[model samples]
Target: MPEKQRYTLPTKAGDQRQLGELTGAACATLVAEIAERHVGPVVLIAPDMQNALRLHDEIRQFTDQMVMNLADWETLPYDSFSPHQEIISSRLSTLYQLPSMQRGVLIVPVNTLMQRVCPHSYLHGHALVMKKGQRLSRDALRAQLDSAGYRHVDQVMEHGEYATRGALLDLFPMGSEQPYRLDFFDDEIDSLRLFDADTQRTLEEVEVINLLPAHEFPTDKAAIELFRSQWRDTFEVKRDAEHVYQQVSKGTLPAGIEYWQPLFFSEPLPPLFSYFPANTLVVNTGSLETSAERFQADTLARFENRGVDPMRPLLPPEALWLRVDELFSELKRWPRLQLKTDHLPEKAANTNLGFQKLPDLAIQAQQKAPLDALRKFLESFSGPVIFSVESEGRREALGELLARIKIAPKRILRLDEAQDAGRYLMIGAAEHGFIDTQRNLALICESDLLGERVARRRQDSRRTINPDTLIRNLAELHVGQPVVHLEHGVGRYAGMTTLEAGGIKGEYLMLTYANDAKLYVPVSSLHLISRYAGGAEENAPLHKLGGDAWSRAGKKRRKKYAMWRRNCWIFMRNGRQKRDLPLSTTASITSYSATASRLKRRPIRHRRLTPY
Candidate 1:
């Protein structure tokens, strides 16, 4: 190690430094160390939601500090539908802790950090805390719930919903997973019991319960009036036809109205960073700046296209989100940070913890000695190896696999248990493994022992399919071939053509019907087309536009579907003890369709393969 390059964390309240080459799960370990040394909690700004969630699980193995993940809405920037109740609940719970969070880790995705959250005063002010022996006001509490954006329901099953019947009141708090059953003795103090949402049975007792606002923004009369006035001032449009304005006037939270979060408050909406304590440290990783640029470009495109629609107008991107420059300005405000720079090459520094990545163990399953490489490392390695599996089930499965080779490993829960040189089993969410030379320990995961698999990433955000989609592009078909259109029947395929319609240019499939009549269909509508395989493989007859033959073909398809469904019901009715049967599957339907296609001219024979 160099004289200046040390492994110690940032000591000051606000300091910006660089950390690099800290690959794989070592990032989580470093983050855990920072939180312990700093006076305030550490806020990790992950590149995406998947990366944030992975660190949230792995960091706990290193530190006992409270770890929480501030979840994203998982909806697009201007999506019409609101986020799920559970996601909102998780977010509110985490936000409530941020203000006075003495020490811990808060993982937030970069995209989520850009959006403006509810004002800090709004969340803390609206929150209601109740203790077991505290007196309860039935009528006042009911009115408070309604004003706080909670819905009155017949049964309390989801968060932000409450059900009341006389003395017994059931309410699912925004921060809690289960509904609480409160038994009130008139207006005096009573008991609070946690109950199951599904079975409606009491599970246990609780000393105290913290109740957060049902929605991020308040929906009280003052908030609504403020929103309506701000909407008029900002939009400067006719409000009579706008559904959002109408609903706000009536104190109704319309679906997808979360996009208009800025309008709900008379004061300036605060950025996500404002919710954190002033002295809190923020860390940056990966290509966050590039990702933010991509997100901004996408949002701008949506803004331009959505301008024409009067029913729901979009707020300026700057109003709802912070720009990349603004994010960096906030990042520099943190007292302790390890920010990754895109332009400059990293030098050896105090922040950098030199943890080498573990070498891959290519386990050949087919060979007699599949564990040869792993065995060699286990025997030669000087430090203890903590093998971290993604889940408890994977840890058990790994133990069973290693036992065949006579390598009995001891299972432990924490990193402190790996004291000496040996194999230990631990469950974590590490994507890759690393070895800390100074600590004399190495961390490995299931992917190291096994091999890589297709890791699932964030799915609900903006996903752009190139040139339409894989299903839309019929690149397998030659320029000249017979194709079947669900609505227009048989046509001769003539490849794809691009044209401008309504001032928007797009690709379309060019198909020619009988007598040289041509039809152009958008490439996006590929679900309406299929390969022609009805009468003969190569000699599919082209149906003329506005012809009877096309209508007859559709009728035949409907009958075949009906017949297949009826046959399935008949077989299941007289089954030989069919259990755990799937109601229906696309594969089964496709198999039946293929078999029926082979014998189109005759009655199809039923093949019995049990009821399921």
Candidate 2:
């Protein structure tokens, strides 16, 4: 790889410094520089979720250190539990990584930092790391799971649930992408494999798995008694309190109980700030004073509007969220750096940590002639230059563009090729690009040259495909909501209910149609049902049960889809034929003529064709 630009900033222990007017890439470079100088955990806070994610992506380009992103659970007024499983998993993973003392970077939004999390003691105690040959009785394993707040289910599908059958046990652990299947030979673990929840098939074998608690709160007997006692002390005898207390006493927790997790603990809950080491370097993208104030105001407004309802009791704002002043106080204990997108003032205060202004290295926007701009940039820059495109297609396009300008840039798959000083021009793929003027290198991105952002391709990761994955979470579904079935046009979703068929129990989705007709769809067929989203929910038309009209409409839609698929196949086949060129330069020109004639007879609309 090209040597990273080495720059120094005025940063000291127990000092707060403001970095002025650095772009996203510049900020990331600064963070990487600070990380190299310091030898501890680095926490970077952004103004919002979008900024946080963008900064994380930028920082990854500079360093290979363990970088974790903490996203907001959601912005809903009052949620018993966060609906986002990924965010919850990410938060837990970051917390788990923090205690290791391994150097890493954590990017998080200001709002996320304000929210309180489960105590560090609880998280450390509840986390389970099991390896092969870890001898433990089945009963003891069950008790461990119960203490970790996992619920026993008929089948292991979503996180926090487990199922046992004969000598086999399946568990969907928190912070895990897929559920694990343990084959026990009379309590001694025989084998373990990660399996797909939807197909109920093993994917791969593993020797060890680190499992985190599914929920934040404890669900054991003592935890229940503590919660009940706290609930009685907080609220007067009311219907909601009594109902929640009854459920907790019966060893079952109600939905949205996560909001009341603080009540379960006798001591005060801690914010994320408390978990960090004393030497951790805290970096703020913008003015922390401004962002924290806005976050606190927005949170207070949400709590004020929603905290008074008896039907949904909300945890007091002070208990669940930290004030701006309190957050600043906590941050003051660590060395803090503030990044701004504007120049610093002349007579600014807080000079304990001096300022180092980085040079402006923004790429000039391409005007009408992109080829001319590329040619000029290539000829003018003597140092190493890398052009980053988004995809293979863009790479080819850029190569063709450069070829027209008499420039033959070598296409390199890895950054190691650019380390050689002799190679000036190279092409590669990156999500975003920037120039490091200090290193005498420039990275021109496709977006900067073409003025069009490419859609990033998501990397495929192994995920547990449960029935819930096929549809919305059961908690999000409600009666009388409009739902659409592949066969049935549109109908109202009633609710989920259990039915027994052939002496085997299964859950099903109940849908209501016209004339009070009901259709019970097996949970396995969840992929066929979707929330009605054609138009306005109120204006959607419901179909009658067992109607011929629905079948006819479905057939017509299938026919159109099939035709579209055929067109896509033809386009792909033609493109492949073009790419399968002969290596010999003396190949017959007649073959090209024949291909051109065939193309003339069936003209290919390259622009209209979508990638397969």
Candidate 3:
């Protein structure tokens, strides 16, 4: 059997507890252990001196040694560094090639020190890499974790994650995956393992690494250079500026060379370098709390405050049901408006109490009451009204009530068709009360109550209105009139015929066009079908068959249809004006003042702060 490699050595049980106390100190101890095992002086690199100090202090206590060369490395000098990129590049070249005094290690958090390392090529132990086709390649699976980056305890949790492209892969594997291997090949596998998300490992067997500093990892050099230059202008005067000038003056800095270190490396060296060991214990502080209930409660409270009740009608059931019945009675004229119901009541029930036959529906207990206000409203208004129903049962019940009340229904329209009908009185469900046209308020009545119909028809200032009735009237499509086809260009619809296919029969329209060509279209394709813009009646006798004029007319109609689809009806109401609705004078003044205060106090740049 092959030997098993041990990644974590067994530490005394108490050692684990001691490690927990110091987040930074624990990391130092881990790095020291690895350095001792490797018999090399480790170099610890950090973004700034403060980070270096914290790490250094922890390591010093563990090793009881002052190997931190505070003077030689940290105190280097630099000058004439116009662009920060140039200075950084010069320094890294010196550090990477500079032979180790004892055991050198670089501690660079993130790619700041290494720059421009393609995330795709970064590999860490048990880290996941995603390839093309959104596939993941995971190594070193911990059954409990099974995936990297997912169960990690780090804040802004990242690392041990990999994604793949057609032939490329990206992995942010942390310490577990050292010098993550990169596989490149032509329909074959070529592997190169180097990089640690924590900067722990480096190229083990590669001949040369075209490594750039952690900061240059991004593909855009200009952007990185710009940022680095800006950062330098602000804070670069410290160790980095000093080190560059000293190296350039001494002629120790290399020209045109950028040192790139593996993520697995302990440290990134430039102006300063210190020691770090492999397998350093790094603990991230902060907890991520999951509270779904809090979010749900907050959202519920907001809706409740707005008077939105999901389980019940926006208005009381008694008020809503009564108004609905009064509206349905007025739409029973058209044949197409016949209400379809499962079963009819043995006799008409006084669904609307103390009402008989349509118009007398005005005879309610009290006209001013909220439940009868709509009936009073209908009687007082001089304009025509159209009521549409969506549900069959409601339509039928409403039809019976309307019949019992003796109110004439002008039109029953499908919600989609009626919105554009341009009638004076248009009543329908407001589509979840959001005032959208997608929903239809339908009125249907049963068979015994033949007085109620599914739809009605009425004349309007612009055109005749009745959704159900209009649909039935559309049945009389003429040969010369323009008709739209789902696929074929606009042509004159000659006539309708039933075609038998596979023992099934379907009705289709025969359309003859300008070229003397004919096309067959099925009725099921109604959405794509529509009528041309010519009036219901034209001045001259309609021409037979097809011509250029019809095609041009069809195109014009299609364009208009597209524009119509984009149009939406909007009702604007300011709640301040709504207070005029019979509110007490004293209460109105208080409400207005409160509203004014709220408006004044609100921040101009008000931002919604999401609850945690």
Every candidate's lDDT: 0.72, 0.65, 0.31
Model 2 over residues 288-395: C-alpha lDDT tens digits?
A: 678788877777788788777665566677788788888877777787777776666743432222223222222221122324655676677676666665446446
Locate the minimum summed-lDDT window of 10 residues in model 2. 603-612
- For each candidate, give its TM-score against the true structure: 0.71, 0.77, 0.16
- Model 1 Cα RMSD, Å? 15.6
Give one digit per residue, the lDDT tens place, for model 1 in 1-612: 011324555545456567755767878877777767667888888888777777887788778889988988867788666776777898898888889988898998888998888888988899998888788788888999999999886666568988887788889999887789988888854889999865678878888888999998989988888898898887754557347888778777777788899888877678888888866777767777887888778778877877667888888888888888987787666754554422236544434455777776756443335567877777788888888765554566567666655767789877777887878888766667888766767887766665552122222332222211112225445566888776677888898888776544556789999999998976545545667666674678879987889898668998998898678556653341244333332223223333323321111111111110
Model 1: number of backbone collisions: 3
Ranking by lDDT: 1, 2, 3
lDDT of 3 at 293: 29
Better of 1 and 2 by TM-score: 2
Look at candidate 1 and give me any clashing residue pairs. Answer: 13-335, 14-335, 15-335
lDDT of 1 at 150: 92
Off by over 4 Å in 3: 1-19, 23-30, 39-49, 57-90, 93-95, 98-102, 111-114, 117-612
Residue runs of model 1 more than 4 Å from their true location after superposition? 1-6, 236-242, 339-352, 391-393, 404-406, 453-612
Please, what are the lDDT tens digits per residue for candidate 3 over residues 121-203? 22222223323222223332222132211222221112333434444333333322132444545433345455543332434
Q: In terms of TM-score, how similar is model 1 to the real structure?
A: 0.71
- Cα error, candidate 1, residue 346 (Å): 7.2
